[model samples]
Target: MTNKVLNALANNSALLKWIVFLLAAFGFVWSMQLFIAGNAYYSVKNSIEVWQLSPDKASTQKVNSALDKIDNALNYFPNNALFYQIQGQLFEWKAITEANTKNTDSPTTDLTNKVFNLQEAAKSYEKSLKLRPNWSGSWIGLASVKRQQGELDDEFYSYLESANRAGPQDAILHKFIVDFGLQVFSARSFHYVKIKERLKHHLNLGIENPLSRDFVLKTIQKHNANEAVCRWLRDASYPVKKRIPNCITYN
Candidate 1:
């Protein structure tokens, strides 16, 4: 049998060579995929583990240590948007903790540190967004950090606008922007009105599902917004035009 196999391969040398080439190509492609997936997994694992350590901002040393670990991970996975996002979140969390601590037992020096942390958080979120422009969560995180940092600049609003544009169909994303706008912008301001209208457009585009309408109304009312604006429900021409009693009035 071995002699017969050798004789066949010797006769079909071209076929044997083609078979070897195919096998090598398949192995190379499989190895490349595994390498990419392995790197992604390692980056994500490091990110999760850093947060798992439960760094406390009140203990500056602990927060700093966790940050150092994250930085080290970034050295290997610089493009891992998730890690950058987590770094942004950790910095923001530290800022909140620092603010709360300042209210009770913090020293004057802590105020400077709190500001620095917020600034760093903003930069981190921006970096994450640049790496993953279509990530709605990263946009929202940037918006939140900017808001916390008292940034009412064009950049702050752009982050939110980009988020809504990136996920117009995402009901939760619309609600978040609306809720945040209501809290920060005056009801009569152009920014607030634009955000409300954009959210209304999203709902309308969603076929005006009754559930989304109800959710939006509830969220608006939660922010002490006038129930009358629920008028957008009927105005948007949703299929379910049934007026909500307390929420929607004929007047």
Candidate 2:
């Protein structure tokens, strides 16, 4: 019985060695594949970053170059929100450049091109928001492009409201809403009520957040006489109003 066992072990030793060798080879191949894939992903991502940080204007050649980089990266990470956001930003930049183009040779043609660029930018931002609905930055980007195109009506204000909701703590978004309200609506317009509400909300937040406090104060200092600020001051607690010299003047 012992001799039979020894014979069986000897017969299967070569087969066991082959099995181990195949497993090691398979592991090496799999590891190499992962390493190659990771390196490609990072290289494309870095190229996208380089194009984004570049100071070059959004000329046709530069836009194409940046889009190409983003496309390559998307091939590897198709659902990446940042890539889509960057693409939207590039389109927005292109729109601004087009709007600023002074084609003395063909003014009508330049206007047509500018409109087309803004449309493209809006489309890009819509696509990005579809992928990432809660992205306040994309909303702001879209709102900015639309505002530049003179499309800031009721629907435009809705976008700003959505941006505020999506990024309540974003100081920049707060500032943008304040600026947009002041620029687009007359202080006496009912629409300015939205701006007042936004200010009050931020002021309440300012009790605990230093950034919010500073931003609120800065906005008040800049637009103290605006109806929204005066109304907010009037409606605020007496103590709060007393502390603000501008509010006293409004009274």
Candidate 3:
């Protein structure tokens, strides 16, 4: 009876050990699955936040850093359209910085560099558009670069027109169009146009027309009157009607 009791006790101990081992195995598997799921959620959440934050901020450094993080995430999920779009936007931000820093004394060289950067930006935006054709912002970005480059005026206009058609309700798109029109006027008058024509075309009477008025107003607001261009701009602003042409009136 003592030997039998001892044998039964040994059997119970072995069964308990097997149960404990199985439980431990299950726990390990469950823990691993939870960890993996948590990591995936964190990664996706971070990516979405970065996408949302990039376009809202105007700082170049911040935009670039966000894009770098997004690119790193893409190694794991290579097909994220948002990542591509944000990357394109970052490139565009850089291009805008380059374009706006032009030097009048070295207009040719400065413009050349600006054009190169803008073209690169256009390529990146085109890539984003390829991934997500419905993104109106990408089309606007592409058009802005084309405008900066000055090599494809018609194509640039077409892109802007398409962007408008795609989403006329987007106030940001309209603002971009307005700002771009102003920039083009500033650059053209500052570098390309003769003083007389610049005044007549950009600042003189009937200039308040929709197309030219915004540009004239923006130029006067941003530049000083000491320069010849500024002198004309100042003179142009005197008569309100003279500064803006009737045809260019915004409804």
Candidate 4:
């Protein structure tokens, strides 16, 4: 009886030891997984912080260095569309800096450089559009470059229309289209009444309202107009005959 009791006690001790060993193994595995997950989370967070800081760096040298780091990160994550879009925007800023230096008054002398920089901007914007086709700002930039080149008016208008369709809430596009109409009207040669009539037709103005009145006022202000037209437009109550009669009559 004493031998049987001792055997039973020994068996219980071994069984408890095995249970403890299994529990310890499970705890070790859980701790390791937690450590690995925490490290990965921190690493991804740091990488995103670096990318966010790249564009905000003040100095051009610092910005370029940060951008290089971002570029490497982007390469590692090629599927990230936002990174490509940001790269394209940086290229646009560089191109604008280059183009603004070209003097428009000497178009013949600066034509090559001007066109080259503008084309670079257009390319960057095109790439951005490819990454984000629904982005209206890219289309607007494309249209602006075409307008600057004085070519592709139809195409430019089409792009502008598309931009409007994509982002109808954006009032700036409507303003741009209106300004373009004003520029075209300003370039034409017509008497005040005829000019006003043409603007009303083209701009869809029903009468001599505030916008149409302002358009005529701006036209007189821009051109070397006779004093008569200027005075009348400036103060509509002024008698027309009190000043010079026509644009051709001005010195």
TM-score of each: 0.54, 0.55, 0.45, 0.40
Backbone clash count for every predicted candidate, in the order shown: 0, 0, 9, 0
Error of 3 at 170 (Å): 1.8
Q: lDDT tens string, model 3, 1-251? A: 69999999999999999999999998997687556544643554454344333333344554456556656655544555555555565566655544455567887887676566566667667777777787777777777666556644567667866776766544335445444444445666442232234233334432445433444455445533224443445545445544332322457
lDDT minimum window of 10 residues, candidate 1? 49-58
Rank list by TM-score: 2, 1, 3, 4
Report the Cα lDDT for residue 213, model 3.
47
The lowest-lDDT stretch of 10 consecutive residues in candidate 2 is: 48-57
Shift of residue 136 alpha carbon in model 4, Å: 1.5
Best by lDDT: 1
lDDT of each: 0.64, 0.63, 0.55, 0.51
Cα distance off (Å), candidate 3, residue 9: 29
Q: Which candidate is the best by TM-score?
A: 2
Per-residue lDDT for 194 in model 3?
20
Show the lowest summed lDDT stretch of 10 residues, model 3.
191-200
